[model samples]
Target chain A: MRAVFWKELADYFGSWRFIIIFAVICLAALSATYTAAQTIRGDIAQTPTEYVFLRLFTTSGETLPSFIFFLSFFGPLIGIIFGFDVINSERSRGTLSRVLSQPLFRDSVINGKFLAGLTAIAIMLASIILVVSGLGLRMIGVAPAPGEVARIGVFFLISLLYVGFWLGLGILFSVLFRRTITSVLAAIAIWISLALFISMFAGIAANWVAPVDQHSEAEAILEHERIYDSVMRISPTTLFGEATETVLNPGKRTLRGVVLVREVEGMIPGPLALGQSLMLVWPHLVALIALILICFAVSYVRFMREEIRAT
Target chain B: MAPPVVETIKLTKDYDGTRAVDSLDLRIEEGEIFGFLGPNGAGKTTTILMLLGLTEPTLGVAKVCGHDATREPLKVKRITGYLPENVGFYEDLTARENLRYITRLNRIPERQASGKIDEVLEIVGLSEVADREVGRFSRGMKRRLGMADVLVKDPRLVFLDEPTAGIDPDGASQILDFIVSMSKEKGITVLLSSHLLHQVQKICDRVGIIVKGCMVAEGPVERLGREVVGGGQNALEVQVTESSANLIESIESIPGVKAVECSGDMLSIRGDKDVRAEVSRAIFENGSLPLHIRAQDYTLEEIYLKYFREE
Candidate 1:
């Protein structure tokens, strides 16, 4: 298991494909940070300095999106790129049988490769976040409080889990499809549908499930929101977006649309504690985790029962 | 007598509604190169998979090195290695790096793995290019690298499925000679599966001819040849300058001579054994000078064709 893990890790880090993608991600992230630092500096008096460090991830400047936005959008691409060809390429290269013929259990192959991918994702995301935070601190000229640091750490963990879900999906496609191109296309197709089109799909489905107009009651609007959220959560991107939004912006307390003013009439108007923020996104975190496990488990079972051929 | 290194009892496999392998039984002893000869899709690979525990058999047991392949596959895998057809390596990695991964999978320590990698590379004549990426290697070079990979683990038994496939004739012969030498020097048992009869004919100690998943014949090359061509029958041809009146009678009277037919300048004799000397003497004794006498022997081609036609 260690052998496969180390080898895959080296492969991921050394391949030209991975290098190019890593460069794109870093450049985009740093650019997002540059813009975010500009916004924080331009309006220093208007914003509170309490969570100023966290603002670096959420604040979008004139030309670029926030760091968390790019991560939420590109995290699946990283996972899919790492996993889409993991098994099928081995099959095409006629190495599957050779590797399986060794003294390792069949599960070890999948386990090692998956763990290696996760490690690569973790390293990439961690370094990017750290670099962005350091740049943001340098630009904003404010040290982060311990609580703010903890929130950022949890946000990193949540992003890892979110990307892991996509990694598992990529592996699942690799196991299910024999051709590398086919698996890659399948992974990308799903990513496009979920990331770029799922919210649109959810809105349409929610409208059909619960119709609402200007004359509709507040109860009807709430029902429509409920359906939309449920449908949106079908995509890990939505869950990731909601989780990171709440974690990085601690003042946000809900994942649903505001249907009535009375809902927050008695609620506090300040950032919640770290535990409270975690509790708020607990379901999203659980859903993301469940997505990862389900994808991994399905691929695991399929690979274990798969008939390996040297084609 | 030594215990059999590999044994399969009534091993069968079915895919969907069709049976790929029937209730086939096979036994191979230590230090023997057993040729699994068959046409395309004759279940040669399927049987190998079952023996390696890469795929489970629908019925029956495959035991390798005294371990049930299905029940205790890791143990079987530990003592055996497999060189798949068109064997592959990580194209972007050096030969040593690719092999290091295998050694790691086998749980060999780094220092030992490095030594073993060097030793196997030396054996395969890849030491000069050990650090060169495998993507730049020729097909024959990759096949040799595959051999080095199989040997790095020091397995007791090796299953080579069409190891010489897609290589030039010179390279194929070199690989065959290498296999012979490896077995002779290391005493490692080999189960070689190939549809190319002549490629394996010279190196295999014994051969099993499978047709439509059934074992049609199993034994040494000459034995199978004799069995398939009819019970030990031999064909002999003789040329004489002149015909003698009683030469035909004399040749027919020779012991073990089944029949004799005389042409203008040639005599065709059929017998249970070599009767060339006796027939030549008979011709000379009868005043008919004999010029040339030759015996016709069976090759693997004839034997494979005969069985394949029967099936």
Candidate 2:
């Protein structure tokens, strides 16, 4: 297990593909950091210590999105890239059979690769967060509060799970498709669908479930929005976006997203307490992890049963 | 007196509706080179996979080194190395790194693994290029590295599937010699599958010829030839530079002699029993120099063809 982990990790770090991915992710993170810092430092209102740290992740200028937004958008690329080729390439190269023949459990090959990819992503996320923290410290001219640090930590975990969900899906595709190129194309297609097209489906489903008739009452319109959000919540992209927004934006009191004035009346203006925010996003976090686990379980079954020959 | 190193009891594996590997019963003793010969789709590879427990058998069981392959695959894997046909390694990694990864996968400590890696690389004559990335390697070098990968564990038995399939003659002969020494010197049991019949005939102490998922014949190469060659007759092909009228008549005088047919410079001497010695002596006595006198042991191809035809 350690062997496969270290080897795969090393391969990930050394390949030109790694260089390409690292460049894209770093550039995105850097741009997001710049825009976020500018938005926070330029704010005229007197911000609290806990809220100031939160602002660094959630603040966005007119032309740029926040750090969490960028992460939720691009993080799947990391996962999709990690998973799309891991098994099929090894199989194609004939290394999978050789590795399996060694003294180890059959699951070790897939397990090790999964663990290795996860570790690499975790390390990368940690590094990026640290970089942003440094940037935050420099731009905001103050150390973040302990509670804020805890929130960021939780956010990181959620992001990792979100990325892991796609990584698992990528591996599933790799196992299902015989060709590496085909798996890659499939992963990209899934990413695009989840990010852009799934919301459209959710919108359609909301209308179908609670059709917005021409003379629909205000309550009917409110119901349509609620149904749309519920449908959208089924997507990992939506879960990730909603989870990060709730974690980083303490002002976000609910993910049910009450639009009616009556439901918003009791909401506090301050950022939700760390515990409260965690409670709100726990289901989404669990769902993201469950999706990852399901993908991995399916991949294991297909890989174990597939004939280990050069056919 | 020792139990067979590999024992398959009515092992069967079916894919969808077709039986890829039918009920095959085989026993191979320790330290013997067992050649598995079959045509394409003849179940040689499928049987190997099942024996290694990379793929489970549909019925019965395979035991390698006294461990049930299906139930205790990890135990079987620990003692065996597999060199898949057209072996592949992580192309971005050096040969040494590839072997090191296997050592890690096998969970050998670095202290012992480093020494073992060097030893295997030396054995495969890959020490000079051990630090070169595998992608840059020629097909022959990659095959040698594949051997090194297998040997890192110092396994008691190695399964090599077409170890010399696409290599040049020199490289193929080198691998053949390595297989011979791996068995003769190290006392390692080798279960090698190959389409190169002559090479298999040259090195294997025993061989099993499978035709369409069934074992049609199994024995030493010479014995197999003797059994499969038609009419239980031994033939001698003698080429004489100078024609002598008395040569054929003298050879025909021997007991068990069937006929002596001459075509140009070649004399085909047939007998119900071994008579090559008597025939060679007859040629010299008749004052015609026998430029080439050789017993017609059917080539492995001929024997394979004969068995395939019967099937």
Cα lDDT, all candidates: 0.89, 0.85
- TM-score on B-chain, cand. 1: 0.94
lDDT (tens digit, per residue) of candidate 1 on A195-307: 88988988999899999999999999999999989998988888988898899888888888854788778986898888888999999999888988899789888989888
Please give me the DockQ of candidate 2 compared with the native complex.
Answer: 0.72
lDDT tens readout by residue for model 2, A1-311: 77777778877777676678767777777777888888777764666555677778888777888888888887889899888998888888878777778777657777778888888889888888888889878877878888888989998999999988888898899899989999999999988988899889988998898898879988889899888888888789999999998888888887765477887788767767899998998999888978988998898888877777754
Error of 1 at B63 (Å): 1.6
Error of 1 at A35 (Å): 1.9
How far residue A70's Cα lies from its native spot in candidate 2, in Å, is 0.6
- Candidate 2 docks at the CAPRI level of medium
Model 1 misplaced stretches (Cα beyond 4 Å): B240-243, B273-277, B288-292
Off by over 4 Å in 2: A46-50, A213-215, A264-271, B238-254, B258-267, B276-293
For lDDT, the strongest prediction is 1
